[model samples]
Target: YMQKVAVINSLEEDMKALPDEALAAKTSEFRGRLQKGESLDDILPEAFAVVREASRRVLNMRHYDVQLIGGMVLHVGAVAEMQTGEGKTLVATLPAYLNALEGKGVHVVTVNDYLAKRDCEWMGKLYQFLGVSVAVIQEGFSQKRKRAAFNADITYLTANSLGFTFLQDTSTVDRKDDLVRLAITRPFNYAIVDEADSLLIDDCRNPLIISDEPDTGATERFLLAHKVKTERVLRLGHYVIDRKLHRISLTRDGMLRGRPPNINDLWEAAVPMGPYIITALRARELHRRDVNYIVREGEVKIVNTSTGRIMPTSRWTDDLHQAIEAQEYPEVEIKGRTKVSSSITFQTLFKYYSKLSGMTGTAITEEEEFHEVYGLSVTAVPTHKPRRRIDHEPRVFLTENHMLRTLRLLLTKARSQLRPVLIGTASVADSEYAAANLRAWGIQHQMLNARPQYIRREAKIIAQAGVPGLITIATNMAGRGTDIILGGNPKGLAQLALENTVLPAMAAEGLHQQLVSSLPLAQKSWPKFAQLFPRLKAVVDAKLGAHDTSEGPDVKDAGGLLVLVLSMQESERVAKQLRGRAGRQGDPGETFTLVDLNDPLVEAAGLTSGMEAARPFLQSARRYSCLPELSSLTQDAVERTSGM
Candidate 1:
């Protein structure tokens, strides 16, 4: 860790010493180096130094050597696990500075309208300082606005926003009518994903495509008509399941019912209850929702689940969205939508970068996944100060009911401890259940999950989470990019304390005594012993601007923030992300759950069967039984799922 600090400090000095001419010239040298088939590693230091200095001259902001090193890692295409508040935005300047010279343009992808605009205005300074023009894309921007932005040397845009625009751009009758349409020929340049994991991985499974079709009533009629007919058939199960093929076939007895002509004409391929039939029905019955997806006028508008913003321009292609809407609103028009063009998959999108690398606090365990999927390995960046987080493992249960009872008990225990606990739930339904149960038990907790607004308000809740006796019920994923400190939140003191040095006298101060003790030895070495340490003062005064502040007062006492997760999520990926929420950057944190037969993933994966066998013996300890130490079982499940 100290060596890393030394390297960072050295790089900062090197950047400060270089002259503009000498620094800007590094771009040419690196380009030449690349042309000669030299390794990026060979030119990384000089290349990074050049961009670092260039950003200073161009944007008046100099990169910390750590940022330069981060840029180097990105240039080599790896995941740099930089912590929050480490200037990840400025860090990209090194590489964006290098890649922009290729003249292909670079795509800086963000999560929402807010981030896109914010990053451009903020991070754009570095690019502009370095002689690169920056443009931002937001929803509802005119074609001219989009064109001007995309034409810039570096274009910042939201992942879905850009994708949807790409689709709309291509569908325009005249190419000259829009900017994205104009840039259609520019080829996708380097794309730097902000919150890379969400846009690139969590959303990878969905395709971004452009579709075109002549609107007709025939398609609309089919949707309404099918919904009416299938509604009855589904309950009856017109087909019997073969299970072996995971297929449902039309039963001999049910086939005898004469097929209705209207339904037959619209869906000749859809035999009710068969795989195709079920899929078409499921698409309508389960896919689209007014809350998550709204049908405005005649078109389907996909809601941004993470942000809760209305994606007005987002549409369902090839009739899927329309089909689902038809089931929900039988009276609405069900228009035919067709796919016109597409380029997707998280792997393919990130691969477009000539050089790709990023810092995320949560990438070590996913190093292999990153390598396998995006061909990027993970490199851990030590924190400036030793982490002092504390987390605990789940206490398991035999049944969902038992898990609930155990949770109530745990919640009671947590409230008694006065060590604010954050409970992560697997579903919206689960969140509601927990909320109701907690309320019944006289527990006061804040709920945050899939609601789009909740994510935007992440800092607010996390900021308040440290208040002793506060309980926050969050979605399993709500913990990302946010840290929980111990000894309850020192309301309004975080920004000042975290960044500035804490003084001995300040440490001895009454209200903050508990907080100062939570600091590591290195943290306690700062200059003053005044009323407030510089770090604490800095944290308190830090201008978080529009972005959420992570600065929290350090606290001492029993285990830090208590993290209580109800069930393990479906993907091991989620399980990893959950554990990651705690113990950030070597913080002393513990994470535990009450896992048993009640969790859906366990049942789906057959772990519940094993629990069933062990149920009787573990009755008295029902709700607190931890997941048994079954190595062979875990290994078998992992392999089986891998094969699947």
Candidate 2:
């Protein structure tokens, strides 16, 4: 690593000396070498140097030596565990450029469509400056647009899109012309997944499937099951539910009561009613309103458990989705399921890539999983500055209500100090409840969740979260990609302008006014910003106007941003991602995790503990029990499932 950095550093001085035209010409020259049979490794040093110079000139952000090391780690097909503010997005450019030279697309996979679009527009500027084409894959794009995006030198997309596209291609068996619309233009060449742990480990179990034509019989069965009222089923003792496991079984009496006429036939055939009962049970007991999903436009949308984003295209397999629609919007059509024409797990899909790498704020805990599944290892990239975020010991309570009360008090205290607080909740319901509590106290704050409406506004919400006395509540989706700037985000002025209109002149003038009056930036920071973004500057007498450099710091004296985590995620890595939002780029900040024993993670942990404690007793009983094999097998299964 040191040797590679040394070579890259040696070329930087020479590359910086080139004129703008000369620097721009270098991209073509590098392409020429690659076309002439030179490996990416052969041009690594100079190519990285060129990118470094380009970023400095274009974005005014210089790649640190550590970032260069991270870039190299990614280029070699490894996970670079860089911290929250280490500019992993910029580090991607090095490898992205090198790999894109091969003319087979390099995919920069993000956690969601919002990030995919944000990064493509943000980083596409840098790549476009270096003569590389970029495109984004998002929902609602036409087939032609998707093909165009996939054909780009570097395409930014969610892992779901990439997986679904692959599945779609598999369904196309007709002819060569038909394949054009279904296929992703490039082969599975090189991919750099953002939030690697969330995508590769936490969400790996679910397979991507393209359904065949809807089965009307299955739809009828779902409709019939939906007609059986929940209260009637419970009152009649027709179903037994295991709340913790989210499973339901039909009791003998209940089975007889609700059993279809062809119960015996269902035993041997693919029973639609069996799945209907399970799905109904799960929808009623396991999936809570707003907590697990939200009702929007009379449709049931699956909330991404890890990110707190609404996934409109995603649906439960079997009859689970229709079961949900049946329960939520009884008047709407109960969509029937198609046969799974094609399917692939993320584990299997990622394996098709010629080369794979990933970057995330946290990955060490799942290091073994990464290596075992993707043949990738994690490397902790050193931060540009020493971390100063104070992580307080977690506080535990007996119930969620008690925790909420304590959380309210903490928010009140943080508000008094004028420190912007970001509270990370586990679900949309939890975040909504937090918002409600804050509102009851008349606390002014912003709420972000997985609702479709909030997805587009996420970038701005997160960006300005660090301003004085701002209380922003969000789900895990806000944890990655977005950066929480200390005091204020100056760039947000430009973003706001662009969002308001597409006209460049209007945006530039509008951004100037917002920067001068609206931002909470320190007076000293303005001149530096004006110089960095000359196009957005409104000058007077060869100097920035007095209004441009007059704003005072809003919350710098309040100890910067404070992060509050309301509940624990299933993985410690995810918890770390939330805490990471507070202390960024060595900024002074603090974070605390308040836990309730009723939280899913806490409940799971307790269950694991109970299972472990009972293991020896089960073993002892097995020695004398007639069903020794079954007992031993149950013990082993418990150990494995509990990760003991």
Highest lDDT among the candidates is held by which one?
2
Angstrom error at residue 524, model 1: 33
lDDT of 1 at 370: 73
Best by TM-score: 2
lDDT, candidates in the order shown: 0.59, 0.77
Candidate 2 C-alpha lDDT tens digits along 347-456: 88989899999999889878998999898999999999999889976665544666777788888888888788999998998888888888887888887888767776
Estimate the TM-score for candidate 1.
0.69
Candidate 1's residue-wise lDDT over 465-488, tens digit each? 655567888765454445554433
The global Cα lDDT (0 to 1) of model 2 is: 0.77
- Span of ten consecutive residues with least summed lDDT in model 2: 539-548
How many steric overlaps are in each model, in order? 48, 2
lDDT of 1 at 585: 36
